[model samples]
Target: MVRTAAAVWCSASAVVLAFAAIHLNPTRSEPAAASANGNHAAVKTLQHRASQPHDADQQLNDVYRSHTCGAVAKANAESAVGQPGSIPCIGDQVKVAGWLEFKRLVGDNVFLSIRDIHGSVQVVFRQEDFVGFTEVRALIDKLPKQSVVSISGIVTARPQTAVTEASAVEIAASSLVVLNRATLVPFDHQQTNVSEELRQQHRYYDLRNPKLQHSLQVRSKVTQVIRSVLADEGFLEVETPTLFKRTPEGAREFLVPTRTPGQFFALPQSPQQYKQMLMVAGVDKYFQFARCYRDEDLRADRQPEFTQLDMEMSFIRPIDIQNVIEKIVARAWLEVHGMKLELPFRRMPYQEAMEQYGIDKPDTRFGMKLQNLQACKELLSQASVARGFRVQVPESLRSPFKKALPRLIKELALRNAVTKPFNGLPAALEDATLAQLDLVGADFVCIATGDHAESVLQRLGKLRLAVAAELERLGHPLRNPNEFHFLWVEDFPLFTESDTAQAADGTMALEATHHPFTAPHPNDAHLVFTDPRKVRGLHYDIVVNGWELGGGSIRIHDSDMQERLIREVLGADITKFSHLLKALRTGAPPHGGIALGFDRMMAILLSARSLREVIAFPKAFSGRDLTCEAPSAISDKDLADYGLKLIAQPDTKL
Candidate 1:
């Protein structure tokens, strides 16, 4: 049909006759006649006007002088013609303007389409309809795709052949004008495998592509929904300072130096401190569109700076925080995807999650659930703790690991070993402990044991993901992207032995698994000082499709206990936390909060490959902003004033 339109637009008089149809019958009570070939009789008159191109030119000039090419938007067109798969603004004449998305020429007519922020519409230009406006046709012919233009025309019900994204109705232009012109793009934005560097360099052009536009739009709407839902739940939206004191909140913070030589303020890793302070201030609830920063190793999913929907509440239980976040999450899914999730998402304790899936954040959509054979074998053992037998899965699946397992396990043991054990396993269960269980469809099962059980288990978890990916590539998709599976991984250990931290005797000392402030379980409070390893924090993490969506924990309110935690378990400076300690000592209520990775949520909502796709202007893998060429060296004088210096290294270094 586009080809036919191209052929029909060959003649130049199609616009001349279209003008007469509108002017001569501005409000004709009867419709124009259609011939046996489906061509309007007016089109026949257009052919007759072909002999007088000069007269056609003059008529178009008059129409151009008389009509206003003001503005009619894609949104206006959508509103006027709101039916699905079709626009129906027949007989309504208006001026529309937007970037020319497409163009085609036929016998004596032209078909053009334009796109604006809201949507796109098709414009039909009959040469006869323009009368003497030959310049209008000339303007279109000379312009490139994406040229901004305006058209004054009557909305006519399109013929059956004309149905498309523009719908059942189209504007038959009597006059046209170009507002701006765009140069041809060097490459197709539709190409999926475009180079990342090139796309980042030309992010503006990249965003103009429909895919990026759609993603940002949905992101905006979902954010609004989040705000609305939270507001309805009594969360007071608040803004906190970007420049804060250097307090330990994990991840490296970017420091901002002041004019006072050595003074510095650190950027927040999250609103963790401020939100907790809000709770101390007696604020019942608080939330913020928080901007967080971190100078960590970069990946496709990690950014130096990102956005999070951070919220906190006072006098709330772990379940209360979970319920609050669940509603917002469910609301987001409903508003963005129009699907209501089942209420009360599933729950799994941190240990169970680790035992079953090998990771705290488990993608529950599909399963290659892990089995703890050692735990099962303990009851069967008559002697001490069963140790040491390595069972590689079935022989078929075990062939690849000529020596891979031992090497990786050794590496994990060095970096993540909780305790160096006696390696004592009863001879009988030695083989079973290390034995890999051969499962139904899978070629083999993976099992690991050591002081670094969590570490080894995490490695096994990654291997599980890789295997699942391979199976999907081979035609069995275990984890479907379209399905969302959410569960709360609760009852996290209050303390874990940090690989680098050490006790007085030099053995690995206990450190806050989540943070120093997390309160221990009521029953486990006595173990905080005696056996930190056994204490469970009242914490929970919300996992969705295998991603750690968000996490929160009940906070410690007792100053003495907080001091004991800081000075003993974590072995940190109590003076540094004097402010938080004083606040806790004050009359404060039990409080808890959570911060959702808003950027990741956006990526999940749109199935974006990475968080960068959802961010407006993300930095490159090198942590440099390509668009503005950021992170450049500062002036020598400015550095000197800030009490900073640049070391002159050998020319061999970057």
Candidate 2:
């Protein structure tokens, strides 16, 4: 009857069957619960492989390591011999397994260096202690570098004069077993001159390098810290859908077609709408390490697909969101850099950041604030000097600054550079310019003419960064690289003028500076309908050094406000975002969220030159996955399954 009952349970769901079987059969359950008991004799033998010395010295064995290479080194360093409550040290037998890194022959002794994922250690084989030393030495000589082997040995203290970084102690080998052998590798692990193409092709080997290993380890530690901090703050980790409908949020998206004719699903550029919906679902605090996609041109800081530290909250102002993000960032820095970051970072309005530094994301670590010279035209007779800035470059940087001046002037659509002391300028114009700016003997000024006030400031901002870069290259950095300057840049203009686009009345069209979801500032709310360009969005960006760490805004939860901004103000297609509007109408709360660029964050932490260094598998500049050679051709039959056909070849130039 019991057997029949168990068989019946097995016919149901496997999970249900397993539960039932465990309850019904004590014989089966006991062994599964514990490693060893009266029912299992093999446990004793399995335990013997870890610490006990083998009876025969020359005999090969299949059993592997009892401790890691790192662990072995740590054990010996704790005490001279062996200490109570610590791992085995001198004169104790142990087993270890790893790939061979190198081999050396000295008289009648053979020395081998082995390394695993954790660390490396040295193994020594002596003729006096081994019965078949000559044969083993010959075999070791024939083995290739990076061959996998397991060796049982007795631990011994390394000679004081002979010890190096590989290990502080040496292992006296009892016996060895060959597990596998590797072929000759393409390039040395640390070879800097290796071509990137070849290294990418053999990325598995490339990842074995110590620098990459350390980078991955740090990445894991930082991610763990973020998870712990968010979890402690009462945030629930959630996974949102990636296959979503196409909507005009920002960048281009990757489209996935279905068998249903003309029906398609687009990969989400972000988890924006879903996270907002999570707020409506009563998940008050939510977060995810989301994988996002963007079908756009790539750069050093960007990839076709990347990870984002996405999060959202309900019943929060812009400051509330900023505070939470600052906590997360501080915790992450503490874990990596072992320093406490100051709380309540400095805040600067977008207008001030642009006016003083010439860029929205300003690196406040250095000084060289831009000065608006609009007052100069009032002192001069020239009427066309509509907008200008008095740029003062240091005398020490005059040569490099001069070299970068011509290119900067051409890019900004500005006029010539003016050296101090009024070389060829008329006395009146020179006096007007000098009077507007406080200039020392080492400072020179450049005044842009006819450009808009905003354009002039932005161009000067570029010049600010350029000067900083040149200063650093010339062995006189403006500020220390290690110093982190955290700032909150907020109160940005809601809209920007489009270059080639026009509105319905043929006037200049406007685009959202951040996104359409951002609510206008309380003081500027009325301006949205009248003069939208003058309205300020309640958006905030967290910047560090010169990089925009992340951004978020207090979103407009009211359906009416959202629709007006998207349809009437920005002139976007209403139908594409109707679903979001419907969700908003279903009694959503006042909510806000942020998505931090995880790749860029990692690159910043590691001080890596490219985002590809931090990513496990990143696309090349040409958007090609060199490892697998992806984005390959699909067969016609496979295309038919999706109810689609290739229209033309992919553009090689793209």
Candidate 3:
């Protein structure tokens, strides 16, 4: 199921009350105001004037009032009722009254979905069912969604679990009443123009699809399960500001200009601050299924707006928070997929992870471990052949092997440049370097006719053997498909070199790897000023199947450290976050939190190629919705409503 971040504006209490009312009176009277609404008026008129009531409404109401709408009533009605047009049937001979949603008309029979009061109900009719009603055939051909009609037929239950099965059934029409006609554009007619995106824009019709209906239903259940699980764990489900003052986070904020003029409120990137503030307000635990917005590039796994299970707790250690999350996740898995997840999942340090897998979130399901070439360079050079093959060297220098050594070293350095500075090559590389290796012969060669051809060929063969051996070694068990590897990357560096290393104030500054709020290790406090690279924070990430599922850290609860960290590491003045600092001064408890990607989780659960498969209405890869035509040109009046103006491209003369 696609997990969508949709807010259920209706209160749960209202749903419960509505269900209760329906249960209390199965044959409840229609509202007085609805008496003149054509269809209801027809039913009411029949009920009031009939000397002896002969409609299905009167008969069904009688059955419901006497025995109620449950298994017992259904059983009694089935035993007492006869086949269509047969005598000794106590209930009135009624026709199925609904719109034909879907249809298949054979030579003399039809199978169609009828849009009844309760939703779509399937009805199957044979030629005999409407033998005397020629007009019904014409009506059936033109029947569309939301059309209202009454067909008098013998009611019976279906024999199997086919499309036409329900507690009640109808057959053999004595008459056809066209109560209301529908203006529906048939599905076939919209084939060229109706994309899924467009269908979402026209969600009313899209909801009629069983697949979408099931997906949305499952989504609702997931939300309910999340709410129930959190509430049970004594977590206070709180609402936070959707708009607030923007701060420098990882992503660009979606800004909403204010009526007050000049000032603006940024749609939340995540409820990070507000949830933490709950802890300051003495609320021990806080959580919200928050809608987060980011004005950034979109991808299959990302949206312009998304949701996160934002959570925070007071006076809790890192392990405490992890345990809470474990329980919540385990419960969610059981509820959603009916699977029990293992608790206390394995944790691997960030440094260890990069050294082994070259990725923070190592997909535990496979093994293709990265090896460090630098560690075993000397040993590899000593080997006449590396990995059982002769090493290849360019012929352009005095000593071909000696000259290429520098190039090889440069290549190794280039590979290391992309990863964290501290990470090194793996132990396997060292073992391979120590072993004598040879390269296999290449398919083609460049010959120097003036030189001794035999000697040149022999040397070239040696180089080919070495190259083949090295390439073969590089291709090993790391590429195996059967293994699943889950990893925990922790103790990430507190700061990293910024794009512009030199500060405007001529003071040294660095960019925070995670965020300024992350608390550095106590032992590394001094290094925060002297050598920022050496400072490690209490940060951790959960990586599974090669995807970073979530990340979090123990937050800086101490006000002084928070300000200093921001100024020293993030290169930002304290004034920008002064309000947050002030909140911390009010005796904020030690807190930490993580945000789980709900859409990504669903994508994993469904084994979907993209998050779009799980989503009911997702934009295209370019973030365009062909169905609804969203993010299109807005009207000038609409732009004026929000106090905004559009700036045309500089070169566009128009």
Candidate 4:
């Protein structure tokens, strides 16, 4: 009689046994039937089994088993495992399985590179080892690149020089079994014929490339760092509904038809309203790695769907929130790139920034300041008079110059032609006059290097000759990219006058430059009625290298101000925001938050040309995922299952 049981082991030689033996005590009862037959039969069987002592051990050896590897598992194992231990020595005989990433045929011996969950190892096989098996060589040749294979061999430390020179160490090989074959071409050998469309269609393959893999890894690290930092700061990671009620903010939403007829849900453009509502619910610190969707034009920095680290905190001033974020961003930079940013970054008023830089988000890295020419009218007037009596004046220029003088003077608001003393003109008038003349004579005085001083001045002699020949072709001088001008625009107007659309009540309305919820500055609230353009909100944006990294504003938590902001300023229907109004009435706390473009941050950090390079599966310029073939038409069955219907597209006569 043989007792059979199962055993497990990491390697073939190490047998593991189960502890299932039962203990018998004097107090325990025994079955009457067992008592009659067990004593005589057990005694005889025990005596018989003693004659064959190796039976139990042989059965245990047979029970131990190994697993076969697959392609994806092999890839996962390679990444999961660490480098082999130092000091070459043979370990226990083990059976390992994974994909053979590489192999080299050396005369009659083959060097095989195999990776398993434990790690990768190099295996050597001699021709004589498989002397009776011709099929082994044929199978080896037929093995697909990246195909899964199992090898049972004695583990041994690699030779000293071999370990140092080789990409991988450790050699083992006894038996090999192919598990799964990879169908696609190896990533390195993929053809040039591969199209962007095909790459997107087969995104799994596209992501296999080392460059994309590393980029996605970095992106993951960035998000992890953000989550860790925010969590440490007492931020609650709350998830908001992706399907939301449609409310017009700015960008259009992708509507989802509902099972209930005539009703629909809109995909969230952002978790803006919900996060604010969280503040109302007494969840003071809330943050989410939000997925935002929008139906709008796409650019390098813009995506149909993108991610942002959205955060909001209650009972805090605008500056408090800004400081928290500044610390987080600085820490992120230091942790990720080992660079410490200057504390308390400079803040600029919106109005002043616009006036000087002609746009917000001034790149403070370089300088070519836009000089106000109106302040220097005295210089312009003097130069004009001196030019008129210059020794060399072309006859053709004299008449046209005189004709243009009146137009320039009128545009500059000159009091008189010659009688208006330059010094007596107002500062604004002087600056305007100088800026106008400078526009007409916009040639740079290029002093050629190594030229004689007299000869360099001679180059100026050709100015009139060149201007006469190509006056129509040369208009204004080109902007120089080398000169970087940095500035902070402050005091941005809260509203802008526009005529794009009528208000909800069929009346003219003022557009909130930021948003309806942004709070007006305490001192500027009264100016909203008297002069809307002069009123500024408690809003701020951080711009660097001419890119808007993030923006936020103090929110209107007071019910009265919130209602007035929507009704009077934005001209939005009061009923449309009833839920928000209700929340505001429930003792909402003062709060503000900012959402930074993660992709754009990476772009600036890496100095990449486009944000797409930092994204793993970025949509094309037209907002189509070429790799996944997304935005493809859905099957009628799927639509029916979801209780949806497709709207007919308008016909075009192209």
Best by lDDT: 2
lDDT of 1 by residue, 1-654 (tens): 001011012243222112323323321111222223422222222233336676556545543211222122222334454322233345555555567778888778788877665566677877654433354466567677776666656666677785655356677665454545676564575577889988888887677777777888988998898889888988899899999878775678899988887899999888786787788898889998899999998997889999998988898888888898999999999888888899799999898888767789999897677765555445343333222222223454343443344444464543432232223333554454344532333334444445446765676676666656545554555677889999999999998887786789788977788888898999899999888889999989999989988888888888899899889888887887788888877877888888888999899888899888899899889787887767767878988889887797333311
The worst-scoring run of ten residues by lDDT in candidate 2 lies at: 1-10
Q: Which is the leading candidate under TM-score? A: 2
- Give residue 19's lDDT in candidate 1 (0 to 100): 30
When 3 and 4 are scored with TM-score, the better candidate is 3
- Give the clashing pairs for model 2: none
Between candidates 1 and 4, name the one with more favorable TM-score: 1
Runs with alpha carbons beyond 4 Å of true place in candidate 2: 1-63, 77-88, 105-109, 127-135, 165-167, 377-436, 441-450, 650-654
Question: For model 2, how does the per-residue alpha-carbon lDDT over 218-245 read when each residue is reduced to its tens digit?
Answer: 8898889899989998999999898999
Query: Residue 640 in model 2: shift from native, Å?
Result: 1.4
Query: Model 4, 1-654: lDDT tens per residue?
Result: 111111111223221111110121111111011122222211001112224446445434531214222221132212332223222324434455666667777677677777543345677765543332234444466666666665654455555667543333354454454445566753542456776556655666666554555567667777788888888889999999999888867788889887676788898888888999999998999988888899999887898888877888888877787877777777767766787777677778764554334356755443233333323424444321122111122455444443443344344332333422122323453445545534323322111111222222222223222323232233322223332222223456787665677657575567877667788888998876666667888877766667787777778899988887787767778886788899999899898887777787777666666777677788887787876556677778888867776788533321
TM-score of each: 0.78, 0.83, 0.66, 0.64
Higher TM-score: candidate 1 or 2?
2
Local distance difference test scores for all models: 0.69, 0.73, 0.55, 0.57
| Model 3 lDDT at residue 290 | 84
Tell me each candidate's RMSD, in Å, in order.
Answer: 8.8, 11.2, 13.7, 15.8
